[model samples]
Target: MPPPRDTSVKSTVIPFDPAAPNARLRRLVHHDVLERWRAADRSAHAPRIVAVPGGDGDDWAAAALVTARPHTAYLKIVDAVGDVPTAVEAVVSHARDRGLAQVKWEGWTVNPEVAALGFVPLSVPLAQDAESSGPGAGHVRWLHDGEVTEPPYYGQTTHFTCGAVTALVAQAHAGELARESFDRRAELTLWRDATNFPACEPVGLGVAVRRAWPSSPVTVLLDTERPVLLDQYPQDEQEWRAVLQRASREEAGRIGVPIDSHPLSMTTVRSALGRREHVLLLVSLADMQGFDVPHWVLCHGAVPGALVIEDPWTHTAAGDTWVDAHLLPVPDLSLDAMSTISPDRIRGAVIIGRTEA
Candidate 1:
């Protein structure tokens, strides 16, 4: 089993030091947390905790760190703040640039400043009545700083978790945690046959995994279109299996069979693969729920070799922009956002498993 999660990781404190240079904020938080860890009667492995920051541009960056896992952290900042309809969207766009999954704000009040930013006031503790003296109250007070733009603009605070955040942070890291749970050498892979891959008309992502990495299988955790496009093309269960079998036959490793019909549980998929194969391709996506899949595809994990792509016909302005930024030329490819060892490698997004630093 992985080593026990040291709760001491939670005790580390990241302070909001306004005097520090914009680029130096991350280092300052790291030093402060490390100092706290050293002073306590705790093991050296204790995770570091940094308080989320508020502001705009470099001065307004929020702080968070991966206490349990080194080389992991989440940061956010306000891009713009105004009382316009698109104000919140601006902040959301900022978070998205860093690949953060959620935008959190104290939505209970009607601060047009907050309202414009699209902050709908989450029911999080200390979320209401920013002045309330309660547990987690400090976080509430920190939200109201000049860094937020005026009028139609608002901002979201970033939080780091050794475990999970309800939204932005959680959405990005879930896949990392899922992948980390397995023994890498076990040769696990996440597989999704065309039947489970997402599509309005059953289009598989054109990319194919090289045959050698089966032990480190990709996890196909998606909310998918069901009954599968294959059901429409193939006549029977045998034919369905034949289609996938035919596709994977020439590959070096054996493709894992239907470990689960339920499609949501990778654990069930794991059970199905007990000794037969060491990979999992858990499928799930919004296309099945009768909704356009792209908006909620964030609900899915971006696993390496875990083939999840938007239906070609479903593309939109934002989706197209995303594809252009990441895979403009094609679909279903993975690239490391960070190419070297530095915080800037992760400067924009709260990503896990994308860095070796």
Candidate 2:
């Protein structure tokens, strides 16, 4: 059995000096908590760390670590200031500053106040829970049948690289990324090979997969009809979505992945899985926590009515929790809502096929 969590943290509030370096922020929060945050910084997908000063004394008070996701920033509270209510206040305030959309901390099970703070438990969603209009089951039970997993879980170095990371995981699933560890070096290599510099388009991800794993092939699927939300461009809103899609197609073809002028849908995803091929799909974070940016995930199996997803970014601590949501089933209903390309809502996907042994 595991040991109980420490709840004896107590500190006096102290004002922060702007002139001071970030190293000083560590002295303000719990040493134990800061220690863990330090460890997280070593990873490629580490959070952007910061601290909110405590008042009056030298005691380190409130601290949080933030990371940018699809369309919003994710804030995770590391050290609480006081009782549950007070501690929650510290978190909410910091998140508010960044216009944060999703909030999760470690201690939700013990304190109901965390819920009262408009925060929810980072529950691992299952496929069986969501109602679907498609097949029989709603989760990816077949992933556990010994056909899916291979290279295993490795967190992304940057939030924008989820597509690249997903591609790597997909390659691993196809036995193309054979290695002892898909560590920071491997992740950066994929990112370097894939990134469209400013935007993370699907084609860039497909391109990276092909460059890194020659044995396995990926198809970059795009809608032949152009998206109409052209006006929404450059606002960090919808304009870039169209830009990336066009660029992804052009670049995907340039990189040699079978670029398809066909639209993507649940049928496309299912067809790939049926052929024992892995899919790297783009989705919106808004449907889950109200952010509207393109995100990528690996889809390996399906339940009766839903697709099984293994997200690159989960609530796991660094390497502590690698494979999250083995049973993470995305019902057809919720899946469609999130998988559609922004503004245009056109479906897009990059299906990774088996390795040539």
Candidate 3:
């Protein structure tokens, strides 16, 4: 709307000592974040590491290369030090120097922190003439003028937690990630391809498979509905409320906000091992019994104000269809199971900013 905040504005990366008195790079997120991306699949010749900067100013930041023609690259910055806005500018400059433009940018927060920092939402403004899908769309935002890379709420890659991983699968089938900035509707359902999905990601090297083919279906080891949401998002009511309000003007009640719109404080995003994941639909305690809970789904890269609640539970398991058809008399799941249980689930919803109506 506001002429799409100018992402073209560039800034130079300030060289700072990691041990300096007031440096921002030490708190940056890219160095460690690269490990997770690499862990996804390093052997694949297509994606490989290009740069990992050091020192305090370089914290929480990493540069990577996508092994494709034209040598596509990305700069991922999470929990960056100092002003995030400046870091984003530096990234743009760095990309330009590498003979590249634009970025497949991403961030994790209820507010459009990165967007405000010059990165654009891939879905909100929508890319007018960019290629719709395939390798082209994945890296299109970085190449075109006035292109914005707004990823759908669900398909966005969050921290490497079981909840984020499971929710990614759920969003895939539910159609949360398909809406691209361009008119093209990317196929998130491709993740459901058992044979095509990456197996090493879900199970790791402990369980070696017979053969790593392009079409082998490995049973998804991650539990699809284990209450892992809190692990992924982990933000409490206050933070969630603040972020939701900043992202959109939706009714707080719809997002489970209390009448006062205040929920208890939460610990850091990090949780202890063995904490169960949050799965299924989640609503704030305040909105559970509202007369009409509006469920909005993202279509064509925007939140279409439509209500579709055929099944009470937003997520249905592979066996759920059979169970609902034969074993259960009722079509909808009980509301108790759909509400948020932890920070990960609630936080993710707030960050993605969608209503399942």
Candidate 4:
């Protein structure tokens, strides 16, 4: 392969300004394929962008998107017109300023040069890592330690209903129904009931719960009013914001849940667990899926240095399908890092079941 083109680029990292005139988000995203979260995805923390000075009388050199999630400020997306190393430096500088552990790149979609940089996946690449989970594997540390097992495993049949499947697991654990009876696996009726199609968001499923059980004590908590997956992301913030705001309002009004525009905490989640409250949590799957995306899993209990998760997605790695999905223990710091919906959106879990009178 030919050596990467070098243009003696000088790049700077800046917080993405969605409201700026002639904002370059749409064009940038098209260039940065691995950057998962769009402006529509930013219910709270908008990601930072890298800007490079134009060379040879050119208008620009390069641009890229980076995130501020706890694990690492991800550097997986870029629109390069010059030296990639300079752009990488700009992203790294921003990550260091934020006091993050590392800068991550895409594991699945990494090109040859990016792969040569040798950034591993933020979390274990697969659910079953033999080295990580060997004879003394931490993954098996919480196997039978009374960490609220019996929630049962029912994977998502469709790609979009991770939220619904996670909710079902929580409901079962909360005594809304027994595990076996609740195994609807892939029938997708529950997801269809929960989701707002076309937009592909898992909103208003809480209303379905109340409808099924009139006396159910489920409380739906939402932290943002942003419409999900909007038009492959609009370059104009206001043009996008109008549609986002409208959808959020409609969804919130229809679901009848109060929409909070702030962060939630893991401590709150722990408190709910203490009261035998099972929770459906919104987490970034950067660790699991190789880039940041909204994913839901049922939190069974907290163990030493980790949280036990009952993931709704089936483990893709063979022979360890059930082994990996059932009560998977993610490292505490890693769990803490991934347990958010947005940068500013803390505690993105919806606590349901058995509210006090």
Candidate 5:
């Protein structure tokens, strides 16, 4: 039988600093795992450690590493030697105090204690860990009284296929494409069709989507006349990519797809999502992942203060799974800031709408 819940036990939130390592945390979590946590914490959304005191007056009974997004707090690691329920209660209270909507626990194995505390199992895919057997199970407890369903998640098979995967996910969510068709073959094929050589430029991807799904309305928003996503390459490469982008713009015009020469504002994006339209946003991962790589994410839903996005690429080295990427609630201001990429502050998006009856 499991131990009874200790109401007297209280959990304390400790700010995690890799520089000044906590001796207790070091004792609880392994060295390698702590190193991984350190690397992940380099992001803007760094995690905190929640420590629960033991019933016998020990320094810690249970502890968890948690990070807060817009409307949710994600528990990346949980270590319990005493009252598990009380520790979870403290975590929930922390989330509540921050006005969060839910608490997600990344569980490696099935624990009845967490299940007893009302953490329902999420239907995530099995192949989360590419190196090991798997990152076992995932659970979530909603704090508020509302229903929020996550869109289907498909991790990009290759580094350059994020644009294709986001486009595919948007189509699948809108019932324009089959869910089963989100495979490597289709992903690579779409990437081949859409890519401006290596990266999928906004115009090229928008044109490919328009040609692939004629019924769905497609619109491209780019605030620049110069070549995008090729600043890292040589001048010759940039020239060729610019030419390709020009050709893609022409194709977009011929195909009846509107290429708006303006930045897509957050207000417009919110309004489009409200009308059940999916937007493919190009964002830099510097703030989120501590790197300045340009990536594509699909905006599918909206909460009160956040936009729900599906990032096709998972940071596997930082121990991220599909759970971390799918249905992620990013605050409006943060999304707006990240979506503006490059030194030129170039903004780009591809708006896809359902078929008109």
Candidate 6:
């Protein structure tokens, strides 16, 4: 058999400090990329740098940048002068210590060493465009067994199409839409049908989904009566958007769609997922991406302490690929906090049930 894996090699974890520059880290990552990492560090999902010392103990033989969500840790960047296996081991150890369920590595390219360490390649559908494919391959290693079924991932081709992409993904998960049809054309078409100028309001998107697939049952939950996602627009623009939202709500009522005028609770969301229904949640990306912008995400499943979600938008600049966005795990507490929007604390969700035969 092959030589026993090295167990003696240990790694040191250092919190990334933008102010203090380390020669070892600089050698692995460029100055500009380091600045980007610093900005990400300031975000809620701050990353830490892990370094494994060389045999001579004078230089780092391997280094990796990593961050932890509620249930998983992402190996954002990795470089090894030698002993790639050791680097993987060090990162895995850190993830385990953090009480994470899995460790994800999105490599710039395929590396056999990572696969040798029991990291399985995540199934990514062929992208119609290069930007959706992202820059690299994604692999994940589970620390423990749990039910984490990932729905089909579809990256938004444009910035404003998250809502449409998420709605389509929810439909695909429910077998209402074909996975093959999840392309830019479908995305934009759905966006045009659902969007209130730029952003897709809850009622507008719900109405669009209901109209697109009549067999699929939809229920919209919103705690407010005011027009949402219009804060950035001026008075005249807001008025027209409000009128559209009002129209959408009226259409929803006429079509037998249940529009609940209350906040969406985690308990209710869990119940719906338990029934195999998908939830399109409106959340502020402040905690996840370090921004306060409202974004749409699809909730597909739930594990013991976390809920599984699919975020259509990926932070490509921070090395996030579809792996980071697909079936992402967020803690119950964190999801509840992020799902509550600001100013009015608006909580919105569109529950899409399985299509009827």
Per-residue lDDT, model 3, residue 22, is 21
Q: How high a TM-score does candidate 6 get?
A: 0.85
State the lDDT of candidate 4 residue by residue for 189-261, as single tens digits. 6665555552224345555454455455555555655554344454575365445446645655664554444
Best by lDDT: 6
Q: Can you write out model 1's per-residue Cα lDDT over 1-357, one digit (the tens) per residue?
A: 111211221111343233332353444345544343233221212222233333433332333321111111112221112222333333343333534323333221234455333333322221111222211101011122122111110011111110111111222222322323322121112122222232211112111222222223333222332323344244765466545534533231235311111224333323333322222121122222222112111112222222211111111211111111111111122112111112111111111112112
On a 0 to 100 scale, what is the lDDT of residue 242 in model 3?
41
lDDT-wise, the better of 3 and 6 is: 6
- The residue-by-residue lDDT of candidate 6 on 1-357, one tens digit each, is 222333544889888666885788777665655655565333334567778988788788877766654223334443333456777778877765765556677665578787677777776743423455453567777655555665677777778888898898888777777877878888999999999988998999999999999999999999988888888788999999899999999999999788898778899899999999999999998877777899999988886667778888877555456777866777788899999898668999999988887
What TM-score does each of the candidates earn? 0.24, 0.53, 0.26, 0.51, 0.85, 0.85
What lDDT would each prediction earn against the true structure? 0.24, 0.54, 0.27, 0.50, 0.74, 0.75
Predicted structure 1, TM vs. truth: 0.24
lDDT of 2: 0.54
Residue 253 local lDDT, model 5: 89
Full ranking by TM-score: 5, 6, 2, 4, 3, 1
Candidate 3's displacement at residue 330, Å, is: 50
- Give each model's clash number: 43, 14, 43, 3, 1, 1
**lDDT digits (tens) for residues 217-325 of candidate 3:** 2221222322222222335644553443333223322333322122211111011101211122223322322212222111111111111111112111111111111
Task: State the weakest 10-residue window (summed lDDT) of model 6.
Answer: 70-79
- Which regions of candidate 5 are displaced past 4 Å? 1-9, 16-45, 68-81, 113-116, 126-134
Question: What does the lDDT read for residue 212 in candidate 2?
Answer: 71
Count: clashes, candidate 2? 14
Better of 4 and 5 by lDDT: 5
